[model samples]
Target: MNIQMNNIHKSFGTNRVLSGVDFDLREGEVHALMGENGAGKSTLMNILIGLHARDEGIIMIDGKETYFANPKEAERSGIAFIHQELNIWPEMTVLDNLFIGKEMTNKFGWLSTKEMKALAQEQLDRLSVSLPLLSEAGACSVGQQQMIEIAKALMTRARVIVMDEPTAALTEREIQKLFEVIRALKKEGVSIVYISHRMEEIFAICDRITIMRDGRTVDTKDIPETNFDEVVRKMVGRELTERYPSRHPSPGRKVLEVKGLTRQGWFENVNFDVHEGEIVGFSGLMGSGRTEMMRSLFGLDPLDGGEVIMKGHPVRIRKPVDAVKHGIGFITEDRKDEGLILDFSIRENMALTNLFSFSNKGFISGAKEKDFVDTLIKRLQIKTQSAETAAGNLSGGNQQKVVIAKWVGIGPSLLILDEPTRGVDVGAKREIYQLMNELTERGVAIIMVSSELPEVLGMSDRIVVVHEGRIAGELTREEATQENIMTLATGGQ
Candidate 1:
């Protein structure tokens, strides 16, 4: 089970994303593919999986030249891809999802329930998962769904597994379980191509690291031979002095407060406060109701019961538009589906939140719009050929930047960011942190909903932990520690 991709070239219109890219995956080795967004890592993997065609390349499997016309062909050749975005049907049972296209059939072509269930159970057992086969896949937690994805791959008897950001949305406990499964598979002589934005994972789990930057392979080194700083420098082509920007939070008057926030089945009695010059972090495990609370506060989701006070005035926000009028903005976690209009140009997306500022009577001033968009694009360091370029054409990190720039341009007194750095790379993550620091310095309060413990500890002036739709505890920066946060997050004292 070996893969050799040589001289790969890919282009989307005039944008050349990959040029002369090369990658190698050997049997029984955990090979990490490291790169910044748009560094050609995703493009190359897509070509191998038959999602995209390379303009020029030769793919050799076990020293034999091969071509995959479609995903089925690649799958049949013992390759399986677990995308960063989990693809599963919520209405379907876990059993059905695992045997979707590769179902076993009897003599008359009838689905073999007995065989499918047995095989699915075996795969789950291999991963040490306890999910019921007949349970609805959608009703499970993010961690459970991830394990199901892995089970599906194992059921295919894949010799090479490509996992892209497998732990992006998983909790620390779930991540440890996932690592245990990965190790089990490795013991069975399976080769893995692991792609991730978190540099620590590369050092912790991979055998070798290959860095890609600006559509080219920068370098490859054994895990033991290279250091984190060197790997980051290769990926971004520059020295990174500090991972997080320095923050001096000078708390001002309370700008926003939540009293008795409740959403029937989602959360209840959620309460918190954000000061004018502070960043308040909401920390919890997945499904702790952090997201639901923010969505309700921003009026994206209805609040069954609560009071939102802005600048010491009680305000009734029943919808997102109302929240916007009251100087509030939200950046959702699912950026692709919720954050940006993919078909719209970058300029239009950037202007979305602040479009009213450019409107005179009813007509928008193109001059004002262009000036603001240009300034945001430059200030945020978004990489795009032109403002007219489609938002969907940009890389994940750049699209996230566009979303932030749009919301930042709106001049909201309080901004809510959910999973702001989920799939963003190291350099982009640092930039976002700096942006948050700047926003808070300007008297703009921020409410950050995050699953990363380190992020919450590093950037937050105060931390709020939620458990089972309740405020488990609150801690000041000095009082917060990973051990204490975890204890409270799991419903401890």
Candidate 2:
């Protein structure tokens, strides 16, 4: 299907999300959509998908103008959207998830589980997905869950598929597999609208690129005619010279230490230390126990047998509160689920970690809250209408910055970040890395758990690679190359 959107205009109250944006895609090509948070990429797609009414625009599909009244109508028009965040029901089986909302019925209108299973298996086979049909979706690995999501989209028979950050949760192996599937789909003439923060993936798979900035179309160029720097320049309207901050290596005394940390099955015998004025990176592949060990250190999960030593003293951290009191802050990996309360406002979410500081004599002071929240909002450059705006309403990149701001409010001696810049754009990513550098300069130790090797290499003073729930190897900043890190991550010395 050839889709062309001309002069797309959408507004929410006073906020003009998409202002006269134009986008087009060919029938047998993968198109990339690039923009920073709040740049109106999502709003443009939302309008196309019939989730929001366009204030003004003409949507021409296959040279015929059409209008969709709702999401079902849009789906009927052969347009399907796979959201940035995982949208599968955790309790539903993989087979059931694929056929949901578009189930096949028998002659009497009864559900046909046998047919659904066969169809789901066929779709999975097409994508080279190897996951159990009967298993619950939540039980599957992150990469497998993403595959199931794509299979669900394929089952819709969508001529045009809008995939929003589909690879944010995938591993390298899984990503290669997904790219293979995408290539196969393109061979079958499937039009894919790929939105992502990863530059390499975009250049690798996208045939055409449409860059958006500040609710307007900057330009659209063919992939062969463009490069990464040009795409980023178009997205942010400026040259981003440094991808990461220049941090002077200055290792101080050890501020945080883990002695023989062991979690029953998740991880075991993990030992690490974070020094003052240092960024220590935990690098490993998916299911390599990187996240599990961090969760244990944060007191979110049980550490069967371990010792958390802070400032040369063993700290008894039985819960998150205990960890917080001992000056430890954790930025969770799943920001939507664990980092922020969606129902709450920006002010409320930012104050969650430091409520005690804003409250006085069993009462919270509005003035104090405003002062602290306002300071952090400006400091973090969080783009929001007001502090009263709901956190869920913010774009993904801004929401990530808000999460970092919340943790920073606690004045932690050591902050642990798990996949800090996963879904953030390049501009926001550089800002975040610069922020980490400034924090380290203030004598705050940071332990970053990241799957992106480039980030691990660029930001860390020390690298610790994990394999099979154990510390695989450690490398200094001078010695850690991409190849060496991968070798260590794969259980090398």
Candidate 3:
């Protein structure tokens, strides 16, 4: 399962994605692919798996030149790709999703239900996962769905696996389990192409690292030979001074307050208040009801019992429009599904939340829209050729910037950011943090919900821990620590 990609080149129309990129994976070793968004990391992997044809390259597999016709062909050849956006069929049963196209048949040409269940159970057991085979795949949490994808890959007996941002949706416990599985796979002679923006994970698990910048390979080094600062410099082609910007909070009047907020079956009895020029971080493990509570606050979900107070006045927010009308903006966790319209131009997506400001007599003003978009693009340091570019075409980091820009256009007195920097690179992450500081400086209150502990501690003026549909504890900036937060999140005193 050794793979060597030399001088790989690919282009989409006039946009060159990969240029003279070189990557190699040794048998039984975890090789990391590190880069900023739009650096061609994913593009190069897509070429390796036959999703995109390389315009120029030599792909050597086990000392022989090989090119897969398609992903299925690649899988049959012992290469499996578990993408960031999973391919689980929601309505289908877990067993059905596992054996979708490659189902076993009995001697009579009937579906081999018993055999499939046994095999699926075996794979899940190997990964230390517990899931009901007959349950609908959609009912599972994101972390469970992630494990299902891993189990599906393992069922193929793949000698090579490409995992893209695999731990993005996983919790601390699930991530450790995944790491254990990866270690077992490595011992079993499986090679892994680990692609992620998390530097800590890369250094923790990978044996070697390949850094890419602007569609070309910058350098490749052994994990022991390189450090975090060195890898970041090579990825962004600059010295990134700070990972998180410094913030000095000066609290103002209360902007948002929740009293006895209850979302049936999700979260209950939630009580908190966010003041102007303050950053309140919600820290919790996956499915700890943090996101569910945020959704209810933004009026995306029904609150069976609650009181939302804005500026000392209790207001009813039954829908997103109601929240927005009251000067509240929300940036959802899933950027592609909830934050932006992939097919729309940047201008269109940015204007979606502030149509009234950019319209006159019910007709949109292109001039006003362009000016606003340009200003935010410049202010946010969004890397794009034009504001007219489709948001789907932009890299993950730039797309996040666009999402933030759209909310900023509304001039919200309070903003709720859920997983604001989830898949963003180190450089883009700093920019987002700086933007948060700027927003707070302008008297804008912010409620940030995040799974990254370092980010939660670095950016928040105060932290609230959520555990199993309830507020576990609250810690001020001076009192918060990783150990205490984890303790609270796990329901410990």
Model 2 agreement with the true structure over 1-493: per-residue lDDT tens digits? 9999999988889987888999999998999999998898888888888888999989998999977888788888888998877787889988888888888999999988899888888877777668899989888866677788888888888888999988887777778888997888889898999999899999999999999999999999999999989999989999999888788968789998888999998898888899999999998888899988888888898889988899999998888999999999999888888899988999999998888998988899999999999999998888888999999999998899889999999999999999899889999999899889998999999999998888999999999999989999899999999999888778877
- Number of the predicted model whose TM-score against the real structure is largest: 3
Candidate 2 regions with alpha-carbon error over 4 angstroms = 105-111
* Per-residue alpha-carbon lDDT of candidate 1 for residues 366-484, written as tens digits (9 for 90 to 100): 99999999999998888888999999878778899999998999899999999899878998899999999999999999999888888999899999999999999999999999999
Residue 356, candidate 1: alpha-carbon lDDT: 90
Q: Once superposed on the true structure, which residue ranges of model 3 sit more than 4 Å away at CA?
A: none
Task: Estimate candidate 1's RMSD in Å.
Answer: 2.1
- Model 2 clash pairs? none
TM-score for candidate 1, please give it.
0.94
- Give TM-scores for every candidate, taking all chains together and pairing residue i with residue i: 0.94, 0.96, 0.97
lDDT by residue (276-311, candidate 3, tens digit) is 999999999888999999899989999999899999
* Backbone steric clashes in candidate 1, count: 0
Q: Candidate 3 local accuracy as lDDT?
A: 0.92
Model 3 alpha-carbon miss at residue 134, Å: 2.4
* Candidate 1 ranges beyond 4 A from true positions: 90-95, 106-118, 121-145
